[model samples]
Target: MDIKENVKKFIQSELVTDRKFADLQDKDPLISTGIIDSLGIMRLTAFLEKSFAVRIHDEEIIAENFGTVESISALIQKKLP
Candidate 1:
């Protein structure tokens, strides 16, 4: 699957307790909407690093980078060669 789908899947399966998370749009606001919390972001950062083989720098762990599946996918794309 693509990065966006993978990200959405990760959020759905691991981060949020809400099953409706599976229906969030690609560009939906995960954090702002309370679908994922601060701890969830940390766990998601780890998942991104391991799953995508991308090193998520401290400065990169912001809303612009991890706000949505689209943003996360964009960050991963930028990290990859």
Candidate 2:
């Protein structure tokens, strides 16, 4: 699977259990929509760090970086190489 797919899968399988969010869109607002909170972001950060072997710095953990699946994927992509 790819970055967006992995993000969507992780969000669905871990953060949320609602059927409505099973097909989370890439542009969906994860933070503003309440799908992901502060704690949720931390969990997501940990997951991303471990899963992708990328180190997310403190300055990078912002709404712009973790706003949606697409944004998160972009952040991960930047950290990858």
Candidate 3:
């Protein structure tokens, strides 16, 4: 699957309880929308680490790095090299 699709699936399975994450389009700001909190952020980072086979350092776990699905996808792509 593509990055956006993978991210959508991850959010649906990981965070959404009902149809919450479904409203969250690719451009929607995850943190700003209150879809993710501090704990959620940590969980997402951990998921990315395991899912993408990338080691996410403590310093790299920041809002700027995972502001949205697109940003996280970019980080994953960067980690591949």
Winning model by TM-score: 2
How many Å off is the CA of 48 in candidate 1? 0.5
TM-score of 1: 0.90
State the displacement of the C-alpha of residue 5, model 1, in Å, after optimal TM-score superposition.
Answer: 1.0
CA lDDT of each prediction against the hidden true structure: 0.85, 0.89, 0.78
Instruction: Note the clash tally of each candidate.
Output: 0, 0, 0
Q: Which predicted model would earn the best lDDT?
A: 2
Tens digits of per-residue lDDT for model 3, 16-81: 665756766777788777777787877877887887789989898888877788888888888886
- Candidate 2 per-residue lDDT, tens place, 20-65, comes to 7777899988876788997788899999999999999999998889
Considering TM-score, where higher is better, how would the candidates rank from best to worst? 2, 1, 3
Between candidates 1 and 3, the lDDT winner: 1
* Candidate 2 residue pairs that clash: none
Q: Give Cα distance to truth, residue 69, candidate 3, Å.
A: 0.7
Q: Tens digit of lDDT per residue, candidate 1, span 1-81?
A: 988889888888887787666687888888777976877888888999999998999998887887888888999999898
| Stretches of candidate 1 exceeding 4 Å from the true structure | none
